[model samples]
Target: MEDINLDDAIKLIKDDMHSYELLHDKFLSYINRDPDLKNLVHSYKSRFKDLDHLKSKIERKNHEDSMLPEDEQKGPITQDNIQERITDICGIRILHLYIGQFEAIHKALMKYVNSNELALFEPPKAYTWDPEYSKTFEALGVSPKLKESFYTSVHYVFKPRADSNITCEVQVRTLFEEVWGEIDHTFNYPEPSKSKVIQEQLKVLARVVGAGTRLSDSIFELNSLQDAE
Candidate 1:
């Protein structure tokens, strides 16, 4: 409602864990109903569990912090600075099993969320593996030379269709890749000493992961070949 102020909304959300979960589920329900997103996500049942876990973690973190005294709490939400600018405050990431699934999912998602339906979902920023990263593929000796491009994932942002008051981020990636990437992201990979040693180490680890993916693919292919024979 126009009468509702941004500060009140943010206070309710940031100060109360229940309020936050309520809002998150409300949005997730919307996403699940979306034909393209629903199918893509539901294909893997574990994904729903992952989503629930992620949601719970955020809520728990908030609930813990809210116990602190008001004086210790951060700034007010109603500030113009807060209302006008939007950033990566909320996020959801969908991890797939293979690279082939990436583009398929991407296309479907893009088709689902039109330019108009979006009040604020930022234009999809899609990135696949970088050419430099794929160069490591040769070290692992992936015949046919895996493309040099290795991408972490695709990111999408949007305002809730039902309510334009809040924003959310969506991330998509393959399962193996996401697991590996999560390690790096969680630990702050390539450790910032500006040391070649650290960079090389990360590159090597990344290559091993790539090799694992290739090996998995080969086994799958071999099984298919066996079935055909």
Candidate 2:
């Protein structure tokens, strides 16, 4: 690929910005109306990356890799590979009520991938910190990555079809976990909290969030059993 500076990359993205917006809308519309997915989705939010943030991200990523050997470095984002490199121009977070609903939700998302209604940019994996929580997912055949962060979510990158390079990142998590994430982000952003006490509190809070999810799961299970009775 020919060398392209930041300005050129930005121009390239700007010129084709309309098409990205169209792709974003196409995905947003699908999630809103897709019967299998919509019912399970408690709520969702979608966005295209802000241009200013994208610029910063590109610059930071390039700089981070600048020290590596020439052959190993991914040079600036050029027009040729912008869409492929910046996969999450359109990102959606799907929050469900309880852990019990995840299997159905994952299956609904996979149905499209299996039928070619959507294309997988990558295989799905669950990012988890708790061994017990991870075991639940592992039992279902979806591998869990043992990440150190409190972050937990199942990620799927889907393209509209085989022909389109445009991608949407979907993050699925329980509403309980979503609340904990927002609360924990306060101590983590910009830098981790300087206070060791705060760090310990956050860990305790994370465990509380996990317990809440388990309790939610149990309540839902009881309701289902009562219905069967």
Candidate 3:
């Protein structure tokens, strides 16, 4: 896939000549109805708006890899990079504050998308069994397909009815999944014919990491119970 340069990305984001407003409106409207999602964006936008605090948080988490390199950076304020930043004409992130909140947000999103009757791009292998956690998504009425990477997320392709001029991609991911995504972002996708050994290795890693997360959650719960007692 050909990547858009920083300059081109800025032009796309800045040009009133470009129709980003409609895309933004559609996404905002979708999220506005959900109390959980609205609060998430509000919380993030507030905290992330603080440059020093935001920089410190990102630095502490060691997630600065998502930022564009100096050579790849654009603009005076560096305000724009929508293409690379959001991966869509309209980029919106659905954040889950607690790990347990993922399902609620996901269910809300499904309802909103279904109501809007948007078209989606379903990859053949999208599955959503929380391997590390004791609870299977099957019990939650979720059987989302599983993609290969450790970061578990779904990407949907949606286009507007009024104009087919623009296309948007929606990425649904848990917070932990985003970390996994960043770790593997540099890797290239597999060819149609891929090695089973490579695939097996990745799957094994995913399970192990997921189990670790579940254990952490379990321990936290235990501590909470002890405190209560």
Candidate 4:
């Protein structure tokens, strides 16, 4: 990684910025055109990763790898591998109003993929689904979940078409989860929060967010029962 020139890498990213912008617009159009997605989401947003942030991320990853034991270390990031290694240079986020909507939106996405309405660069993956959340979704019979850190989102790596080399990451999360994520990212990201009080509070807030989601789901379930009655 040290052997690779940072200037050249930044140039590569800057030169490709226009292409990413086009890809972002293309994705936004698709989301808007899909009636199910348009009606399900509370908000939609997208961005191209800043050049400095990209460089810092590469440096951070390499630094962390250096600190690991030899057998555990992931390989370094070099200019040659940067484009292939970093997947989220272009990101799109879809925010839903409630937890219950995730399953429906997820199902819509699967149908889109199966029908070839969208082209995926790789298999879809969900991030930050702890055991409790997994059990909750499993009971709903929506989708299988993976346990990870405190965050929560469904991510898809895809291109305008399979033959296109450029890829963008699409993320889906509830508005409640997005609020918590923004707070966590502001205070604890790039580096974890140093204050134990703040750290503990964030964890507490995560639980609160979880409960809020459950409550929202229960309210919908109750309304459905009443409608049926």
Q: Which candidate gets the maximum TM-score versus the true structure? A: 4
Where's the lowest-lDDT run of ten residues in candidate 3?
Answer: 43-52
- The candidate 1 region of ten consecutive residues with least summed lDDT is 43-52
| Candidate 1 lDDT for residue 193 | 36
Candidate 1 local distance difference test against the native: 0.50
- Backbone clashes for every candidate come to 12, 0, 6, 0
User: Candidate 4: lDDT over CA atoms?
Assistant: 0.76
Listed in order, each prediction's TM-score against the native is 0.53, 0.84, 0.48, 0.86
The per-model lDDT (C-alpha) reads: 0.50, 0.79, 0.48, 0.76
Q: Measured by TM-score, how close is model 3 to the native structure?
A: 0.48
* Residue 214 Cα positional deviation in candidate 2, in Å, after optimal superposition: 0.6
Rank order by lDDT, top first? Answer: 2, 4, 1, 3
Candidate 4 residue spans exceeding 4 A from truth: 1-3, 129-132, 136-149
Model 2, TM vs. native: 0.84
Better of 1 and 2 by TM-score: 2
Give the winner by lDDT.
2
lDDT of 2 by residue, 1-229 (tens): 3333676676777777777677667767767888877888899887877877777777666666676788998875656787788887778889999988998888877877888878888777898787887887887777789655577788888887878877888889999888877777887764568888877787777789889999999999999999999
Model 1, 71-163: lDDT tens per residue? 885533333433223333555677655544444566555544554444444555544344643443333232122222233555666554535
Which candidate, 1 or 4, would have the higher lDDT against the true structure?
4
Model 3: lDDT of residue 172: 56
Writing each residue's lDDT as its tens digit, candidate 4 over 177-213 gives 8988899899977898789888888878887887887
Candidate order by TM-score, decreasing, is 4, 2, 1, 3
Residue 212's lDDT in candidate 3: 58
Clashing pairs in 2: none
Residue 63 in candidate 3 has what lDDT? 34
**Comparing 2 and 4 on TM-score, the stronger one:** 4
